[model samples]
Every structure is written in C-alpha cells, then in structure tokens.
Target chain A: MTATAFAFAPGDIVRVKDDWPERRGPAHIRTPYYVRGVQGQIVRHLGDFPNPEDLAFGRPAEPRPLYHVRFKKGVIWAEDRADDALLVEIFGHWLEKP
Target chain B: MNILDTPSDRLLAAVRDLLAQKGIATTAEIQERIAITDRASPGQGARMVAKAWVDPAYRARLLDDGAKAAEELGIPMRGMPPLGVLENTPDTHNLVVCTLCSCYPRGVLGYPPFWYKSAAFRARAVRDPRGMLAEEWKTVIPDDIRLTVVDSTADYRWMVLPMRPDGTDGWSEEQLAAIVREGDMIGVTVPTIG
Candidate 1:
C-alpha cells in the first residue's frame, strides 16, 4: 500500500517522524487535552479510524487507530496537577518513539 | 432562578433521569457530570481542530467559514454561535482566557478545564500569558513567538490549533490523532514527542 494507504488502526501507537510546519497547538478531537506536551506511552492503537477532520466535515470514517495514551499528570498538567496518574486517548501520529 | 433549571441544568436533569432509568449512574454521578459540563460550548472550537487535522483543504475552509465549516463537520454549532480556530504558527502561540466569564467552545470540545475558568487564570492569562502558562501548565513558550490571548465569553469563543509536531511521516490519521490533546488544541498544552 502507498503511504496514504497505510492504515491507522486503533490500539496501536506509532511515532510522528516529521514536523508539520503549519500546525496549530496540539488540537483536540481524538487527542486528549492532558496529553499535550507530555510524552505518551501508547496503550491503544487502531487502523483507519475516521479522520476527525473529516468528521468535522460531516464525514467521519470507520474507527481508526485510537490509542489510550498514558501521561504523568505532572507532565501534562504540571504544577497545577493534583495527582500523578492521568491517562488519555490520542490518535497514533501524535506519538513519536520516546 | 436556582428554583428553575437553566438549559444545561435541565439537560443535566434529563441525563440523570436517563441514567436512573438505565440504572447505570448514581445521583452523584449525574451531579458530577453536570458540574463538569458547566461550559456551554467547549466543543465549538474543537470541531475546527479536529477538522484541520484531517483535511488540509477543509482546514483552509474552516479559517474562512468557521460556523458553516462546523456544520459541514457534523458538529452542532447551535447555542454557541460563532467559533473561530486560531492557528498557532511557529512564530506565534495563542492562549485562551475568559476574563469576563468562562465562555468556551463547549459545542466542539465538551467542557472547560476547571482552571481555565478560574479567576486567577483569567487575571494572569490576560495580564501575563507567558507567566500563567509557565506557572500553571508548565508550558514555557519562547519569547520570540507572539502570544495572543483570546477571551472566551458568550459573545466570542476561540480555540487554538497548535502547529503539528515534527517526525510524523506517512502515519495514519489515527496516528496523527494520538498526539492531539484538548489542552493543546486550546493552546494550554503542546503535544510532546516521546
């Protein structure tokens, strides 16, 4: 399969190898609010989940690769955190090999 | 009046009634959900972040027509009228604060973080976004990057879509989705590469 054809299945965690120069902050749709800026341990992965961007266009595809990312509450929430354990789900590309 | 439930209050009641009927959640659970769901339209701007991630073309469209674009994305932008997605570029970082009230994009994301609505955050986010972010979220934005603090209120709602991270190549959409966090989407957090 071509690069575009590479399927992102839920429950699988992979790394983002390139930087999108035009990206906004860590956006939320499939990603968790707490996982931003915190290195994630991929706990879930998926294949071809409907692109959230597509869902916004009223066209969400089948469930794609969704990963339950675990982050140290201290990492994501930092000083404001009340605990050390906070796990959240994010899509696959949001990760990079730690 | 506290005697009469607000729209969200009524919605919470309905949710409680449904939960009670289903025997899944307790009265406490219902109350928790209601309490957490105080923000009227947190999801409004989340739709833009979600959309921008999927379709580059659509992302462009969202910048042009945030409201109509949300409708196109199957997100109900009803009570929350206009939601805008502020792109966080390399040179600029965007932060959101509700100086007036806890106005946010509930229609798109779901709810506001308890701290986002706090008086302390409101005061600091406006007067000193860099300091507030560093002290609260632990995100130290470089001084070179322009920081724009947007107000979240009944009149206007805003969300930030931080620049996509580096090192994602030919990854599936789900893979891309993995790093997107609600805070990052709101400019409060940045996706970290592990």
Candidate 2:
C-alpha cells in the first residue's frame, strides 16, 4: 500500500493527541498514555504502515506515517536526571504542531 | 496431555485444533513453527554485534538497517516488525522497554525475558531507568553519561548496541561474541569479561 505523506519532519516538535476511547479502554492503541498530550521532538520517520488500531479490527487500513519522537527528562518523569531523554514511536495521527 | 495444563495451554490447544479443522495449518506444521521459534537464541544477535564491532562497514550497515544486516549474516528477518538499533557510547546510554506491551526484537534476540513483560519493569523503566538499571541488573548509569529510555510500544522494535567492554582490545569476532549476553543487548546489563 502507498504510504501517506509525512506531516512533520525530523527535529520538529509535535504533541501527542490526548483523545482516547472513553469509558473502557479500546482493544488496540499504539499511543501510550504517558506521551498522550505531551510534546516531543521528531527524531526520524519510521516509515509508513497500516494503522494497528484499525488492523486489530480486520479493517482495510491505509498506510500512515509513524515517527520516532524524543522526549527530554522531567517531561515524562520528575525523577529523571538532567539531559536524560525518552524516545518513542508515535503515529502521525497522534501528533500535531506543539 | 498433562492434567496440570494451565488455561493458556488449553486455549492454545483449542486454537490449534480449530485451525487444523479449518485446514489453516496441520498439527505437524504448527509444531514445526514452534520448533523454529524455539531454535532462535540470543546467540544470533550476539553474532551480529560481535561482527559489527570487528567490521566498521558492517556496523554502519547494521545501524542503517538492522533487518538487512541480520539477513546479511544469514538470519531470516521475514514477517517481523521493523528492527531499530539504539547505539550506546561513552557519553550516552540507551535502554529499551515496552510500556504498552512486550514489543521486542524477538526475531533477532529471541523471546524477551519475563521481567521485560512485567508491569513493574515497564513502568519503572520509563519513570526511573537509572534506578531500575541499578537495582534489577545492578547496572548503574553514571552521572556523566546521559540515559535515554526507548519505548518499543509501537510497531518499531529495538535492540541496544552495547559499548565494547574495556580490556578486550585484540579480541576476535568470536571472542567478542562470547562476552555478549542477552541482557547486554537489552541494556539491562553491560558485557563483562566474565
């Protein structure tokens, strides 16, 4: 399947979407709660793939962009040391300009 | 069959039988698949790491594309998620975890350890990696070095390229591979001369 164009480039700071399935948790979601609504810098484009959220339901999924995001220390956890960072892979649909 | 089979074992039997009834895969075929997975070991990833240490060009290829590099070394990477290599240096350290689930580089390093899939490890690895390393594996990240936690919670799985330990200057590729361990590649422990 053809991949959708990348929305954010490397080094761009993007925020994760806070929206999640209300009430009970959804069956599948790649977006973790820790990074939800948090801002991180784009490290690289991890290539496009079918959305796992849709693939879990056996739906026809179009390929979408996924990016490697780097979050600094104290952003996710307060006990983290200075200059320490966290890196995560977040799909494009969950990211936006911060 | 053992009467002590857990619910998970019963669930597997049911699925296997159903699949066989539907002609999806025979019992023998499923057994072969299980054997293939079982045959996979940390030695495969160790071989790649040792070769990378000896060959700079191969190291570049490995950092560029982990799956292709493993394929170059005769390791099949078909039907696995994209593999990413997080490098460790003197100034920077990298640790891998799956906050959501155990999204591991199983094709290369075989199955993940029990601690990797534990809820406690997942949470602590993200919130207090420095402490987690120090306590669980006794691998302390010094203050001089920067600690970077990587979450393999998505499709892209990861493995660490641990720094070559000191006092192993003239070691051969095979010798280097011997010092590499499963935890070393997982960033839970560093390779020691022992």
Point to the candidate with the largest lDDT.
Answer: 2
Global local distance difference test of model 2: 0.87
Q: In order, what DockQ does each candidate have?
A: 0.02, 0.85
TM-score of 1: 0.51
Looking at candidate 2, what is the lDDT of residue B68?
90
Backbone clash numbers for all candidates listed = 77, 0
Error of 2 at A58 (Å): 1.6
DockQ, candidate 2, comes to: 0.85
Docking class of 2: high
Cand 2, B chain, TM: 0.87
How much is A46 displaced in model 2, in angstroms? 0.8
User: Which digits, one per residue and each the tens of the lDDT, describe model 2 over residues B1-194?
Assistant: 67556588888898899999999999998887677568778999999999989899999999999999988998878767888888899999988999988988988888888988999999999888888889888998888999888988788879899989889999999999999999888888889996
Q: Which stretches of candidate 1 lie over 4 Å from their true place?
A: A1-98, B1-51
lDDT of 1 at B135: 84
Model 1 CA lDDT for position A40: 43
